[model samples]
Target: MFAPFRPIIKDPALRLAAVLLVLFGAHAATMAPYVSALAIRVFGLSDSAYSAVLLVASVLSVSASVGLGILADQRANRRAIALGTSAMLIAGSGLVLAGDNAVVFVIANALILPLSASIFGQLFALSRLAASTHPERDRPAILSTLRALFALPWLMVLPIWAVVFDHGAPLTAIYPVTLTLGILIVALTLAFWPRDGATRWPDPKSGLTFRQSLREMANLPILSRVVALGTINGAVMLYLVVMGLVFAATPGRGASDTALYAGLLAGLEVPFMLALPVLVGRVSRTSLIWVGAALYALHLGLLPLLAPTPFVWLLTIPGAAGGAVVLTQPMAYLQDLLSNRPGAGASLMALQKLAGDAFSAAVFAIGTALAGYELAAAAGALLGVIGAGALWAMDRRAARS
Candidate 1:
């Protein structure tokens, strides 16, 4: 379970990469679970507007990710890109805090924050490239471990947020916390992140024009699989979108309950996340992802059904087990799709996010329009299962051919 931590501790590059992800996760713990609430309840956006904000954010985030991925490949300068995206994150946080109004919230969420989201992919790309010289068999473990490191901060940070919110801190306190984290990310990058190819992680420039690079990503095998994983991810996205709302709306539950629920779910997820590498070669990645999708779907579908009672807590079991596989496995699977170009491959995380989030936003909008948050969650669960099956079928066909 802890095997992945060995090299990360011994090697400074791996250590720095690992630290950066933990920081990013800390920032995510604060921001992600609260976005829908902040937009609708605090910032005074309506359901329709909130849905639009999320859809636009997904498109912008993935566009920036794809562009940077291509640029990183050409320039071989993950350091510079990382620094720029970190700055964007800080700026986005500052924008929200400064204006403290719906208009600025819209700009930050739909434009700046989404653009900064590419930083997640950049961190993974840098880590993957840094480990380019490791044995082929060890690569997935390294990436999976980096992902686990990313989830680690959630265990600690979200629980603290839960405590703070319970103690009566304003919910918007997350912005300031996020701002501080972004600054720390910048400091870490400036102080420790290596220059381009400094560690001899060979640059993989395909010498393709911009259009040519995108065309490569447009290939059927890669796109189909990406969409499938994204579909699996959409359920998670929907859970984030509606969890806070459902909890706060429930008579017995309120804001603090929302935070604690998210925090506890995250806490359960970390241990399972650390154990992912052990399953790497023993099972096919898609098979694990498909099974994970089903398990997570069970949790998603049940979350609202049981929200008013203590049994809701049990959802964390499947949530953690499945969350561990889907969240960690996709990183390795997507990266290998374009293994030669580390930048582009890592950016697939962002693209998979784009597809998932686009679906999530649509379901949230349509479901809420037709019914309510419960319907949205159900729609997301169904999509996830179908997506997982589609991915399994696609891979089986490829194998037989």
Candidate 2:
């Protein structure tokens, strides 16, 4: 399991890239468990309002990510882009900290969250560049190992966050920590990001329009299938939104419980991620996706029945297994499809986000209104089943072709 990781880390530049990715993951863990709670408790927004904010943020973030991705592909200085974007993200957080009212808070989040969200795409692009340079290393394994590293910070931080939240600490406490991590990420990128010669750029004489780019991507069967599966998987976001709301509304549970559940799920994912080097050779990527999708369906289906109790959260262990495959495989698959066109990776990322965010917003609005969180989760599970079937079909199609 560790064999794949050893070779990649032996190279200094690759090692720093991996460390930066871990810091990025840590930053995400610190915020994810509490963003909704912060909006509600600190900014005094309702659940629906917070969801709306997220929806908007997702849209804006996709745009920023795609734009930045194009710039990254055409230029070799990914470190500079990462550094600048990370600073903008920190600024956004600072604005939120200073906001005195809901309007100010919303504006601050709108500005920062989208930019911050795009950071993942940037990191993915960087990872692809790193892998491309080291042809001897297993690309999928390297990406998977990076993803496994991501789980560590979540595993560590979530429990600490639980402690902080349980002790009646202010939700705002998370911001400063995120700010510090952002600073560190910038520092790492500046210090160790590889600087190859300037990357190839599209001809200005006949530049690729966004429309042309979409058409090109749409023509690829595998790419289209991956995007479709990812869109359907967006239902998972609905489940997440509902879970956060459920935790907030539960009689005895609060931030600490939410953090614990998320931490447990993330912890469970670590082993699976670490095992990816072995698993990648044994299982087809599409098959792994199929198994993952099935697990997602099971996890969501069980949530309504088991939530608000410790037993329900255990489902996250399996859920994490599913998540590990879903999250890591799609990315690796996308990277494979767009290996020669790194900018396209950004487009694919943006497209998936657009689909997921749109579907999630619709599901949250319709499902929550028709019944409640449980009903919404069930609907999400249904989507997971559909997504799973789609992956199976894609596998069959690929095998036949």
Candidate 3:
């Protein structure tokens, strides 16, 4: 069952992609979970402040990531990955040094988040590069592995922080280590990632005179729908994540409970990602998506009854299964589109990121303003319904066309 990963690494291009993915995961863990966890625990920030960080980071990161994507379109993957990773190393180092200054810390974190969006750079660049060297079905398998690799860092590193660092000491002390890791990642990416190659995809002219690639991507009909679906799903996903924490951290329940529930949801996702392709082969993508959507709806509806108990934890399983469906199938569909038009893949992927980021920020902002966790869950449920409707429409349209 798990043996395919062995062959995945033997293909040099895919292996390179997977390695870059792992490094990206390491970089992302620092900016995302590590930093946000620090802000919440050490700074004694309210849920609103933490939500704002995610929202602000999403906007800036998406904007920066799209710009980097255009640079990728015009240059070699190695140059793009090198430049982005270098930015992360600098930002990570800055975070390490700027420890006590709150303002500086936030600024550094914001900068660090966007730099980590370079992971998106690596994902898009390598996905395109891998497609050039391998068959189309390998794209989903590669993407699933790419996503699954992220779980290892979170599972391994995050719990360590939980165990060792009580308030935010671990985040502060570990900054230097993260910085060192950042430098190593940059060097490895620069050294081992594939460089200039035969025209696997058409290259646009260099020295872009300043036009938004996202606008161009949004203009494409298929890509536009994909971005729309992606945005809605992303927003709902963020709302679910944020509310779950809030519910777990309520007066009766503390941060430990929050952490436990969050960890459970996360743990389930990794294996789900690893197993996704096999499941995809056995079931239609449309069926998987609708089932996932329905499960999310059920999960959200149950939030009013949710409490900090092991029994409540079972609710997360269906939602987690739904999340796996949401996360994997869309990319597979998008990759198919990209295979038909390679030159557009990177930009389209970037647009999907931008749309998701923008909507996620909006959801976080709105949900944070609302006082009740139930309200947030209700909002998420609505978005899930909309996502399911869109998928249903698309599935019907595809059948007819």
Candidate 4:
């Protein structure tokens, strides 16, 4: 496990990148799990209203991601961008915490959160650029290690959230804490970010125009295949959007129980993700993805049957394993497909976020309206199975080509 990261730590720049990812990951973990609950409890949003908010956020997030990716590709100062975005994130969190009505919360979610979320694309672009300087075989491992490190804060933060919720603290507690972390992230990034020239992939004498890059990406079969699979993966994520309400409605559970379950599920993913680099060299990436998809199907399929009991939540362990694969493999695969274009990871991620979030919103609205969270989980399971088959077919085609 430590073997893959050894080479990464030997270089000062890679080491700093890894640290920055941890901080960023912590910030992300704090808010993502509770956003749905916050919307319902604090802002009195219904399922459809929350979905609409997400739809708006998704559109804005896509735009920010594309704009940031182009800027990064053009060799703009990523550190400055990241710092400014972090500040925006803090301000967004403040709005969520203090807002007494849905309108303010919607603005924060739709505008500031999407703007802040673009930081992940920027971070991915930066990390891939740094890794480009290293040995080819080591790149996936290095990035996987960074991803695993990201799980660390989730491991710590979620359980603490569980405890806080149990002790009568409001969910709004997460906002202030996340805001503080966001400020720390800004400071750390500004202080330790590699010099602009030091971390960049050598820029081509002439860069592709935004239109050309979009055309190039659209024409790539590998990217299309990955995006198709990623959309199916997004179905699985619908479970999370409504998970808090699902758990609360269960016979013996409430907000604290929901938090604990989320925390445990998140904790389970850390080891799975940490083990991914080791598995990559031994297991084929496509095969790994197929296995993950199958596990996700099994996990989601069981949700309706088992949700009455707390043990049902354990299904997330398999869900986490599946997520560990879906999360790391596609990014690595995308990076491979666009090796010459340093910003392609960002661009592809932006597209994936747009596609995935849109699909998730649809699932949430339709499934909840048709039945409830149980129906949504079942639909997600069916989609995961479809994704697994699609991946198998795509892999075979790639082998033939």
How well is each residue in 1-401 modelled by candidate 2, as lDDT tens digits? 77767856786656876787788888878887677667777789976787789788878877787667666555545667777787765776677667656887788676666787766777767666667656544777777888788777878888999999899998788878887888888777777765545433221211466666556666767566655666555766665566656777777877887788778888888888877667786888777877887787778777766776778877887788887887778777776676676667755777677777777777777777898777777777777667667767877887899
On a 0 to 100 scale, what is the lDDT of residue 98 in model 2?
A: 72
Single out the weakest 10-residue window by summed lDDT for candidate 2.
Answer: 198-207
| lDDT tens digits by residue: candidate 1, 321-367 | 88988898887889889988877997788889999999999999999
Q: Which candidate's lDDT is highest?
A: 1
Clashes of 1: 0
lDDT of 3 by residue, 232-330 (tens): 466444544554355535556544444445555556767887788888778877677777767766665565556645466787687667666666666
Q: Rank the candidates by lDDT, best first.
A: 1, 4, 2, 3
TM-score to true structure, per model: 0.98, 0.91, 0.81, 0.93
TM-score, prediction 3: 0.81
The most accurate candidate by TM-score is 1
RMSD of 4: 2.1
Model 4: lDDT to the true structure: 0.75
* Candidate 4 C-alpha error for residue 287, in Å: 2.1
Task: Give the Å shift of residue 5 in candidate 2.
Answer: 2.4
Residue 19 displacement in candidate 3 (angstroms): 2.5
lDDT of each: 0.86, 0.73, 0.60, 0.75
Please give the lDDT score at residue 389 for candidate 3. Answer: 74
